[model samples]
Target: MTVAKLAAAPRTAVAPEPTGPVLSCAGLVKRFAQRTAVDGIGFQVDAGEIYGLLGPNGAGKTTTIKMVCGLLDADAGVVTIGGRPLAELSVRALVGYVPQDIALYPDLTARENLAFLGRLYGLRAGLLDERIAEALELTGLSDRDKDRVEAYSGGMKRRLNIAAGLLHHPKLLVLDEPTVGVDPQSRHAILERVQALGDSGMAVVYTTHYMEEADRVCDRVGIIDRGRLIAEGTKRQLVSRLGEKDRIDLVASGDLQALAASMRGVTGVESAAAAADRVHVVAADGRSVLPDLVEAAERSGATLTSVEVSEADLESVFLNLTGTALRE
Candidate 1:
């Protein structure tokens, strides 16, 4: 299906040249009564780029996005878009936000919902109609535009929610956990659409707990945890921070701690630990130490069901930095 490209904003007769990132947040800090939800987090998203905020729940991703959208005030920070401070009303219009929860009215048809939201953005009749049509087409929901939200599948509802965000032709799109719960197919569709949005020149900030999703869609990633941005860079850059270590995950049933301890003593093993039901071994060379790990598992009476070896990936990098898995 062909999605219509969003028309770029019209140039004035003598418009000022633009420079810097389309969206930038600096020293963002937020706190509740007694807890700091976000702490001095900062990053930038340029035009036509996808920046993923990779973190687990309670990692401060939501708080940071809320501050960027002006839904919540940051205890300290500055957010800017298109070289204009977010405090300016005009700059707010340049951002589109899609939250984790479905935000459409169940009784309204997708067309009706889009029209209603478009009007809130001051879109006139003709422009509103064009935007509704374009948003539906962009989200692959044109044929089903007349369907009521209550009658749509979870995926359809989610797409409609996104379509609502695009009604005003935002330059930067912030999506928070947009793929939380859905069939794999729907999740795939949502991810594909997000990537398409970036390719079409919209700067996108995607936040997710899924490491694989970040690897798939992000041009760069900022990893957040415990109210702080612990690391920020391209996947390659982040992985490179781990040096030459390789990650070996041994999925075996038995005394995993014992197996981990035994493997840790191997000459090439850098570190070993047991988490969940797996023994995670970091080594200078996983391939060279695989035989030792296998022998250790056997000696510990752990039946080896599977073994996965890989250099540092986003997941391994996260674990190394945070001392916890993303899924945890």
Candidate 2:
């Protein structure tokens, strides 16, 4: 993938010596009036790593992140950064939080917005200006620095929001669905920027409902479901949990339901579901079952346009653990 052509800037402020993990959470829990939003969850992120939190909407991912950022207090457990507990105000400085929603002033110019936020972090004078410039260049918005935010495209706004988070040169950046509502190009740019951030030595905690994003960027993934952490590991480690199972996705044009049903009894097939013009089939051996699957589709009057087979992925791992599809 081509990285954005960002202007060269000073190296990200060197972080403290890595005496330990960059971010750590242990038995973190949260509760609302009657809902246990996050329950006894724990994980750690090391410097220069991108840790992905994957879950469906309201699976406690947001709540856990809020607690990690100290925006919400956890009812139980502990969150720490660089060996310091989150309760310490000094720790907040080591963390930069990019919320799910746009947090910039739409009426202000991009430069002004970043400058204002930097000032809040005690940045001033030449140092502040340098930080703002670096952030704009990093997000590929330096040319639009003088443009009012309200006049920018959705992708630009999202990129600017991310730039705001880096103005402080944080050690652990927390991004909550930073690409939720944007064009495909914008999402790709954001993901590329995030990967670059990790490559540059900053730890990042990225949360998203998008499975492909997690697969592409995360060094490690934690799957959360119904307020519980179901699994946590690298993609290879998680997929290994699927054992010998294979995942087959077939894009068909007609009678998907009947096609799904037809494939359920295919030799070696374990389960099948059809929705959104695709059929997802799990089998003992995808290669061995491909012919049967194609024959089943043909017998059921479904026209297959595309087919993909893999041993397992983050999506299949999620489904295996939660008993539901990742997007559902």
Candidate 3:
């Protein structure tokens, strides 16, 4: 497929006024029985920017989105849109939400579904019709507007879901795992559309478990785990958090823990741990630390068939800070 045009006509015909943040959540918390699902998480999305919430399963991403959209009341904290508290009914109209699951009627045609949703947002006859057409075209589903939801592919359904959210031209769009289970082609298309939306100056809050997706699409990412934010920054800034340390991986057949213990005492090596068949080591300088690791392995009576060392990446940073894999 061809790359979607990054440079397009500006979103608004009129000049945009300088403004404050379009969306903000501060000290947000949610609880279910005995567990805290969202624990005082906070972030802001500026107008015309994309902010991604990234984490593994059960990380409270969905809960956070629900609170922001006013679908669920926060146990504590506040959500604001365009400087107005979310408790105001007017703020709800300014925010559009696209959930992970498909929310359209399976029996309705694409255009019909959009028109129905548009009406709910208070769009009337001629205006609703026009908005429906624009949303369908923007999502690349204009040609399939007459198709029934059940007849559409997973990706097509996802596009239509997004289109439904855009029916009223919301100032802020909240998307939760929008590309889950989609084909690579569809995934790329969805990502392109999201970028286009942000380029048009709509603030977006996107949540996903895919690290690469967040890295590629977001201007900045907030990493959440166990209902709390462990880290947040641009990919470069997050990786730079591990600047003083380098990572070394070793592949071996026997006694990995024993080998890790030996490597931990080597000069320049800060820490070492073994998981499965590999030993992961953190050091001040990987190049200066490799020889000592090799000699230590040999002394521990373990055969090290291969070794690799490189600058720390986002995954390593996550592991170092949380003691858990980002994908887990």
- The global C-alpha lDDT for each of the candidates, from Candidate 1 onward, is 0.85, 0.87, 0.83
Using all chains and alpha carbons, the TM-scores for the candidates as numbered come to 0.89, 0.87, 0.82
lDDT for model 1? 0.85
- For residues 1-328, write the lDDT of model 2, one tens digit per residue: 1122222333334334445899999999899989899999999999889999999898988899999999999999999889988898867878889999999999999999999998887788998898888788788888999999999999999999999988878889999999998999999999999999888778999999899999999999999999898999999999888888989999989988788778887988877777577888877799999999999988998899999998777877776676456663
Candidate 2 — which pairs collide?
Answer: none
Candidate 2 worst ten-residue window by lDDT: 1-10
Better TM-score candidate (1, 2): 1
Candidates, ranked, lDDT: 2, 1, 3
Query: How many clashing pairs does model 1 include?
Result: 0
Per-residue lDDT tens digits for candidate 3, residues 39-151, read 99999899878999988789999999999999999999999888888898767778889999999999999999998887777788877787777888888888999989999
Where model 3 places Cα greater than 4 Å from the true spot, the runs are: 1-18, 247-310
Per-residue lDDT over 132-155 for candidate 1, one digit per residue giving the tens place of the 0 to 100 score = 888898788999989888999988
By lDDT, the best candidate is 2
| Clash tally, candidates in order | 0, 0, 0
